[model samples]
Target: MSAILESADIDRALKRISHEIIERNHGLESVVLLGIPTRGAFLATRLAQILKSLGNEVPVGTLDITMHRDDLRLRPPRPLLSTLLPPGGIEGKHVVLVDDVLFSGRTIRAALDALGELGRPKTVQLAVLVDRGHRELPIRADYVGKNLPTSSNESVKVSLLEVDGHDSVEITGAR
Candidate 1:
């Protein structure tokens, strides 16, 4: 495996993304973060903390899209995660979906469907740590930490300090 981002690099990238988010939204007002369970949820928490430090408190929540996934029958059954929303919920607020990696875009599509069942947001955005091309759907991230072009055979792995006890992004597999 080859390390594409170290701990410090990940920190810097998150910080930059935070700043961009604030700037793009003209402030964190009415902004909510919904992280896809697993690494995405952790990243959303970290982002909320960063935004808090910047003087704006953004609500962070976890969105489980397991049931909404299109490839459920193609793979083995998986445990379901929690879908927790903020205090005010996503109604009339700008919702940003957070995830560790942006690959085929199927996950994001499922996330959108899941979000629709909850409440109607004024807008929906995507934020990903790594965008490794190969998009099967027409979806894109509004805020990206890194755009690491990679082959389909290669896999991108993201380890967060909260879950993996370390922070780094690695790419592995046949080149």
Candidate 2:
């Protein structure tokens, strides 16, 4: 069986996360939102907008961890990947990494490695639209839109208005 959350719910979740970020950071300055590409990129932009609405000036960036992934040699190769470093290196700034879903945590590991190549940041935290558990690494999101307790055989799919023409989160069995 599959479950869905309406667009309104999604927006509320994002706004909550944004508020949490601002509160935890004691306000925003020299902060960056870097998405993990694909769905994460869209979510990152949305988060940036929310922060901006809250009167915070923050820069958003994108990252491609395809090559830095440990499973790169095992999984199908991804092409046209871009690992553009932030115009301003992460040093002395707070960086919040964004992703659509949190699963085995391997993706976060890869993204961390990719970030190292770019530049060091004063701090790095995670923000995910959905957290499905079953982490294989010691990682946790600082701000999560939703905590979805799901099975290993299932997956959380997040569709954003910018990329999917809709806004919602769905859970379905893995094919």
Among the numbered candidates, top lDDT falls to 1
Task: Give the Cα-based TM-score of candidate 1 against the true structure.
Answer: 0.98
Estimate the TM-score of every prediction. Answer: 0.98, 0.94
lDDT per residue for candidate 1 within 53-77, as digits (tens), equals 9888899999999989999999999
Best by TM-score: 1
Residue 12 shift from truth in candidate 2, angstroms = 0.6
Tens digit per residue, CA lDDT, model 2, 1-175:
4556779988898899999989988888778899888888888889989888888878888989887778768867778465555677688789999999999999999999988888888999999989999999999999998889887987778888888898888988876
RMSD of each: 0.9, 1.5
Q: What is candidate 2's local distance difference test score?
A: 0.86
Give lDDT: candidate 2, residue 110.
92
The segments of candidate 1 whose C-alpha lies over 4 angstroms from its true place after superposition are: none
